[model samples]
Target: MEKKIITISRQFGSGGHEVGMKLAQKLGVKFYDKELVDMLAKDGKYNADFIEANEEKCSPPMCPVMPGFSMPVFYQDLPSDLIYKGQSKLIRTLAERGPCVVVGRCADYILRNMNPVNCFVYGSLEARVNRKMSMIPEGLSFTREEIKKRVIDVDKKRAKYHEFYTDKRWGRMEDYDLCVNTDKVGIEGAVETIAAYVEHCK
Candidate 1:
């Protein structure tokens, strides 16, 4: 059987990363997440920290976070288009390398032609907040209202960033092979369900 690529687009605190990790382990394939930033940094000579800080988020005014800091202008400067171009290029490179489970980074649209198993993971506000609370460090504490607000803000930014980079609508069922509600089914259940779906796809 041909190796399959799995692209998981997930909401904040939805356990998408955990699910993706489990899926990769179950299938014995590599997983790509923040590792993508390191790969991009090596290929593009861009700073890894810079990429991580801005990964999957749009600049508010469409301005570079650090003025005048970017990859060397390849030819004519496509200033406005540079980050999107670089990010898309990086995503393409990773997908081409092997069968991997990619979390976020818009892998769905980036590898659209690769016959990837695309998934979207989301949950209700209360579920998401509870998950976030569990993941928080011991000393740091936040009210339920604060956690809920943070989740909304992060997901909003992700949606905006995805929309800005791709023509296809994000979170639409048509764009994905499977849409799992983490609230309805917990993380491990979501992972097992996806594993079964992947086997069927094969």
Candidate 2:
């Protein structure tokens, strides 16, 4: 049989990471999320911390964290582009090995040739805000309004990042094989539904 790969793209505050991790555990396969950052930085050319913060973000021409360092004017050779190239390579290697669940970094688009099952997870703003508040670091405190605004901001960055790399609008239902609204079905329901979709894949 062919490889079983699932790529999950999610809105900020959605439980896409949790869902993907659980799904991978349930399927007895490997999982990739922020781990991709460490892998990219493994060669030591890139800073792990910087890549972690900027991997899913889209800010052009210069480093977001380090203001002075700037990528060249050319789009293809931008810093994020370099990271995308590295990620695309690593993602392909992972998918080629066996069944796995990959979250973000435009893995769906990167592994399109491998025919991975691409899923998008989203939730209502209210649900997302609640989720985000619950998941916030213990030392950091955010008011409900603040969390809601941050949720929106994060989704915007994700969309921009995806478009920058893939030239496709993020969170569009048509681009994915399955789209789950976590607000409607909850995280477990979304996981179960996606699990079923993967099983049914030929």
- Which residue pairs collide in model 2, if any? none
Q: Per-residue lDDT of 84-180 in model 2, one digit per residue for the tens?
A: 7888899999899988999999999999998889999998889898888888898998899998888898888889889888868899888999999
Point out the worst 10-residue segment of candidate 1 by lDDT.
71-80
Per TM-score, the best of the predicted structures is 2
Off by over 4 Å in 2: 1-3, 62-76
- Cα deviation at 192, candidate 2, in Å, is 0.9
User: Per-residue CA lDDT of candidate 1, range 137-200, in tens?
Assistant: 9899798889999999999988988887888777888888999998888988999898888888
lDDT of 2: 0.86
Q: How many backbone clashes does candidate 2 have?
A: 0
- Candidate 1's C-alpha runs over 4 A off are 62-83
